[model samples]
Target: MTDLRHRLDAFVKLGDFFKEYCKYAKNQTQIDDNQHAWLKKFDEILALAGHKNGWFTPENILFSLESWAELLTPSKLESWLMAYEVDKNKPKSVALIMAGNIPLVGFHDFLSTLITGNRAIVKLSSNDQVLLPFVAQYLIEMEPSFKDKISFADGKLEDFDAVIATGSDNTSRYFEHYFGKKPNIIRKNRNSAAVLSGNETKEELTALGEDIFRYYGLGCRSVSKLFVPKDFNFDALFKAVYPYNTIIEHHKYANNYDYNKAVYLMSLFKILENGFLMLKEDNNYASPIATVFYEFYDSMEDLKIRLSQEQDKIQCIVSKGFIADEIPFGQTQKPSLNDYADNIDTVDFLLKT
Candidate 1:
């Protein structure tokens, strides 16, 4: 058998091992009883993974896994391999620079390296250093061999065959200077948005709220902006999000909301027209503390034109107002296996090794 093929086989076995480990960790993390119980539901796992707020249920977990598998399947990996004419299961060290916006956001990078038969040096985020080791330990339990391939660096970053780094636009400059010399994927800040025809059902709008409010709107994938019809009813949108009003009650979120609101009011009072500024429009697409900031457009055509003009600035757009056969609203942050970060495939990057 080819060495690459053997490594690929080992990776498939590793996936089974890690999946079990993940399942076990879910059952045994050191959270409070309530949080643990809440995690017992698979949907709860999805909500946790995606930073949403629904109770856990089996289907949610099942669908989440199904979606993950479809994205990261062996065939998918091989397709990437075919393009490069390179061996996936070979000696290569991959340095993963993880993002901490969502729970264990850097996990996909770990899995990609493992399944592709590469050694990995993980640089965990300071904001979320606690959870990754617990996950890595479980993988070790599944297969003792994995212990050698994975290393969580608490100190300096070591050299690797390739690199994958994620951060804001500002930090990207540092990443580019440090790792740009090598083959790398350094992601910049990209804000997600949603298009509202104002015709969305209550359930869909509530789910959208989950997308916006989860993680307190810290993720790049979080919906930071919305495009709505000029005559869209703001009251209905606010009412739909009323259940999440408790988020506004939190001191941190309330402080941010109040601060931004005050600044906005002052700016309007000084020069801009109050009506045109759209106070209480909620916060912009970066982080929605409690409410949204909205700008009305006369029609979908106008909104589309504006969105097209600003496509460079906007990331993903969620919409239920007009069906475009493209699933827009729900696809934010919840990345498919094929949805490589920074719009570049990591396995493809590794092929150079």
Candidate 2:
């Protein structure tokens, strides 16, 4: 299991499993006898996942599967690791403290530690307890050697050489207090926002709705805020994103919408709404569910400077021609392998450890 090729092959096979399962689940393909049983297994798993967490909708879970399947190819994995010197590494136990804001939110860290020939001591969030354990089981089934390489922590985490922990700004302090002395990557709350010039096309605006509404705006990559020019009209934007009005049909989403709207109204906040989504003018980067906070900018130059100053508080700035690393309006959630969380190079850190 120390050899990189064996671990890499295991991940590729796992990716194939995900790709085939997705196709079969969608009625786009057929499964053979050996793999037929997995169909029901994954179906039940998705159902259980949704039951455990209301926000883990089947579509969002499937999207996560599809995205990982697309990225785990031989060429993509090789290309990503190609930039780093991965061979000369002493194996160490790495502790992974994951967040459950989105489904499979911590898979990258799990994947990184195991793929680099290190033992993983995982501590999964209660909100996402099932998915990754099943994933690890599948990988171990594909390559039995991985069984000894990964273990889940049910109580306090100990006997790990390093750690990668993700949480909110508050929980991050708790993490630092406990695991502060270890070689670690501790991530805090960071949000994404979009910059608009009021001239976006209909299709672009429609796509931006995906960025806003997907995962119920829970992921760090979800667009929770917007920077728009003064006097920006909302008529065109609302008309374009009207197709996603059905998002309000989900009971949990509808509850959030009703709750946040009532809170805003009672507080005498001036907000704009199109029945499903709300728009409020706020200076903050993080917005509550069902609402997107927007701020007016006087000039592009000044806005760029402001975003630069707050870059640490921002994750991905979804825009066109605004910043060097600006993610496209709708592609924030669909990040590639190189899009490290908090912009920290996990692979490089693990390789050295």
Candidate 3:
């Protein structure tokens, strides 16, 4: 088989292995001593990731892994790559500065670099230090050819042709200053929002709760704000999202809920609370943890115009037939392989570089 095909096969094998670890219980027989050892290590990592970083809850990490497992199928990978003419000649080194806000957030960029036959020099965020390296080892074990192509940076990132960095608005300035000279994709803070027309069913709104509560609303794809009609009643929304009230049981999330609610109350801000989540009437997209900002919209056309004007500040728009590019209620976090972050085609960028 050709080298590219071999690499794709290795990723498929990694996906299959990941499926076995998606659950708390083991269902598959051991493949080999090395595989068994890796599975044991994976179990330990899954158990300790939350202890290492409270944000990296086992459910969220496994959700990420399961999403990747579903996306890494041979057919899906082939379809995602079919649009681009991958150039294997003279592979360039691509530096990746990953964000630690969510689990395995940088895997897509790393996958793009390697799938396009480029060397990947990853600078991992301290918050997400463990999982990717473990996956990298699995990949190398599956295909020895990748051994020389992937490297992690300890300090300065040097001798790279292009860069991809994900950070907050503040750190983006630093990325631009340092990596600006090179070809790069520097992503800053962006949040997702949901649009409600007051006609959504209880099931849809409940699913929308998954979009809001998943990852503790820490991921850029998590819905931090809502756009509802002026006459929209939030009673149904409150009822539908009640199932996720259990999220407040998490200590870190509960702390944020208590703290933000107290601050809003002290400021006398008119906010709606359902014990676990606070809904404040604000125009901002980036809301604090355990809080969701909401805005009232007058006209669909005007709202569309506003969203278009603020496209740079937004990520995914969760809606049901409200907008053309609206992501379904709960699928923001389950993006397909081609659902490139920031709507910038990472594969196309890599192919050009």
Question: For every candidate structure, what is the RMSD over all alpha carbons to the true structure, in angstroms?
Answer: 7.0, 1.1, 1.5
Best by lDDT: 2
Residue-level lDDT tens digits of model 3 in 277-329: 99999989999999999999989899999999999999999999989889998
For model 2, how does the per-residue alpha-carbon lDDT over 100-182 read when each residue is reduced to its tens digit? 99999999999899888889999999999999998898899888999999999999998999999999999999999999999
Question: How do all the candidates rank in terms of lDDT, highest first?
Answer: 2, 3, 1
Minimum summed lDDT over a 10-residue window in model 1 is located at: 270-279
RMSD (CA, Å), candidate 3 to true, equals 1.5
Query: What TM-score, over all chains together, does every model reach?
Result: 0.71, 0.98, 0.97
Candidate 2: residue pairs that collide: none
lDDT of each: 0.61, 0.92, 0.91
lDDT digits (tens) for residues 110-176 of candidate 1: 8767756678899987655645565566456555666888898878787787888878889889999
Runs off by more than 4 Å, candidate 3: 24-34
The better candidate by lDDT, 1 or 2, is 2
The pairs that clash in candidate 1 are: 43-57, 44-56, 224-285, 281-292, 281-293, 282-291, 282-292, 282-293, 318-329
Give the Å error, residue 245, model 2. Answer: 0.7
Say which prediction, candidate 1 or candidate 3, comes out ahead on lDDT: 3
lDDT for 284 in candidate 1 is 49
